[model samples]
Target: MLLMSRTDNAVQRFIFENTDIRGEVVSLNNSYLDALEAHEYPEVVRRFLGELVASAVLLSSTLKFEGLLTLQARGDGPLSLLMVECTDQKSFRAVAQFRDDIVEAPLQTLLGKASLLITVDPVKGKRYQGIVPLEKETLAASLEDYFAQSVQLQTRLWLACDGQSSSGLLLQALPASAELSADARSESWNRMTALAETVQSSELLDLDHETLLVRLFHEETVRIFEKEPVRFICTCSQERSAKIISTLDRKEVESIIEEDGQVAMDCQFCNHQYVFGKEDIDSIFNEKPQIH
Candidate 1:
């Protein structure tokens, strides 16, 4: 069991003793609020973004990569996109792009013909991407379907967000050991998921890791692990911003600087502005290898 406060921004993992089942619980407080503060998202959008953030943290913990994992949902409706990214270090950020007149509606209605894209980018290895059409009513359901198709393990997700606090729980069935038969593994997975389906959104958001886990799985032996802190960390820096500028045509960049006195780049995730004067632009162009 974890000793951290219930309201703390953290994630904890647990395993069922003597079983090949593992789970995770995550709650986002300040990090969720900070992501919302970056834009003027509606309450409905805020709630969805919260769930995305919580889900990202939960899913990132289950991965074997050492870099970044991104979850992006895109469509051609009022709600154009919802994206959340989490790194192996437990830091994450989220952003949403939508029409100004977007209103509260069903997930499919909001994102017409939408699809969920999961991208895993390891710092040293090759990146992997999985794309699946989003045809469910809720984000969690869509993700559950994705897992069912992409992975061999049985995976389940429970997510909730009230625009203030967001939380999620994940349970996955690992490969059966030599001691445990396949029937036993299936039975355990079924029983545990059935119990988890009884969880309420309020309980997930309000109860701490220990209390919540005990409430759900009191009949079983659960071994809780240490909590890992999660925070809002934007990976935008002036150097990275400069790299983007280098990709643009030098003549066009010069024209922009001539008219506006300086070229500016704003990050969509954090809204941080990066400005480059003439000298900075000159230095960047000079440092680059000209094809000439």
Candidate 2:
């Protein structure tokens, strides 16, 4: 199924009634494509970016701050870096770095000796980051381990991308709620996760939130909250890029402008290009940069 054809770009949060298990379902269409269009990525990079996007959105739901959460992977192989940044408002952008001649291969071969980094940058407080070895073959597995060790949450993620759209399903074992015996609580977590283990990529991409939930948990009571919208929003602009140029040494910016006639730069995240003329350069360096 083509997930881009789906009209709703939303993430649905749901909980099993009388249980402490909460989960999220996400589908990406335009946002996923927007992130990929800036560069011509290989098949492996495309699919890898998709999974990272889905995972970022899923992890963003767990934060309580109005800031950006970033997931970064880097290694010594042909594929050097995979980065996804998502905001608390459910918007995201991603980028990757790789050698020009790298071919698709196993995860470790594409990105040998890798480590994963999860960072939360709150708008009003200190940032926090957790680092772990990317010892798993799939991004999902690495993330599952991150949650297990870093947050002490039993989290499972299923992420899929087919070069057009990306989708993900996340199941987390929250603290046990009241109104259940210890046995019932334990059984509930175990049984629900076992059922979720049956979910396939096709089911996640093809099924709507409600139908998918019903299909998976019809025998179990569940409550889905209002769906949240997800969007493709980039934090790049001519204004911001110019400020970065301002921070550089004045002579270097002038030398580059003299040689190339202008300083042209592309945003690392969205690949949006920005060009600075002589006047723009002077204004940036001689005066304070204007921000909107």
Candidate 3:
């Protein structure tokens, strides 16, 4: 059997003509479910991961290089780690680890005293990582705080997820570009963000990007660019899994093979399994040099 999903999985970039502000709107449907299908997660955990993936897609526009952006939240509570990665090609993957016996709690309680790490890995330039304390009620608020403190940019984000789909909106205040006064730029940013704050989760999840933009910024001259699709994809394969086994001690690998007849491994992200017999292990070590 095949299932068809009708939601739009894409990102649209927008800017106002007379203002130094830009933003993005993203919606995820089947792609969101594809990211979650490899594992069985609780409802809260599923929604949290969905929001993370949506945010990653929205932020993927900031990557100027041919590398990737990773958002990681880690702590000691039931939800130990939630991570998502998106590349310049608009491909994304996400995974979450949580204790099963978690109680019903808010984001902070579920994550304990966690920190959110935003990392940008460029192909040619230096890598950048910024850490923000996770103290807010939602990931959107925490990310907005990150831009304010780390990048000194006025930014705002609204994120939402139903169990089946996810959506998000982002507004960033750019520097004065048209010889406009500093106060005017700030005012433009303020009024635009204030209007966006009135949006509801249902609106974000249900309405298309054009309809939602008209609803929020009918009075402003919003210019939306060509829409780009976003997809859920995992970058795991037999070669990479083999490389992992080749690095282990030869004796240890042999012992596992002796007992089980094959060394078995699985990728937690996509739940893909790889098994290496003794001959396969021998070739992995003897056939070629390691790829680092």
Give the Cα lDDT of each candidate. Answer: 0.90, 0.87, 0.88
Flag regions of model 1 displaced more than 4 Å: 1-7, 289-292
- Give me candidate 1's TM-score against the actual structure: 0.95
Tens-digit per-residue lDDT, 1-292, candidate 3 = 2323323999989998888899999999988899899989899998898999988888778556788899988988999999999999889999999998976677788999999999998887889999999999889988988998998888899999987999999998877785289888877888999999999999899888888898899999999999899999998889988888878888899898899999989988899999899999889878644754
Per-residue CA lDDT of model 1 for 19-92, tens digit only, reads 89999999889888987787888988898889889989999999978999999999998989999999999999
Instruction: Give stretches of model 2 more than 4 Å off.
Output: 1-7, 179-183, 288-292
Report the lDDT of model 1 for residue 190. 92
Per-model TM-score, in order, reads: 0.95, 0.92, 0.94
RMSD list, candidates in order:
2.8, 2.7, 3.6
- What tens digits encode model 2's per-residue C-alpha lDDT throughout 1-292? 4333342578889988778889998988787898888889998888888889999999999777899999999999999999999999998989999999889787767899999999999989999999999999999999999999999998989988888888998988877665357788778878988898888888777777787787788899988989899888889988788878877899998999899989998898877789998988999999866553
What number of clashing residue pairs does each candidate have, in the order they appear?
A: 0, 0, 0
Query: How displaced is residue 274 in candidate 3, in Å?
Result: 1.0
Among these predictions, the greatest TM-score belongs to 1
Two-way TM-score contest, 1 vs 2, winner = 1
Residue 279's lDDT within candidate 3 is: 97
Name the 10 consecutive residues with the lowest summed lDDT in model 1.
283-292
lDDT of 1: 0.90
Find the candidate with the highest lDDT and give its number.
1
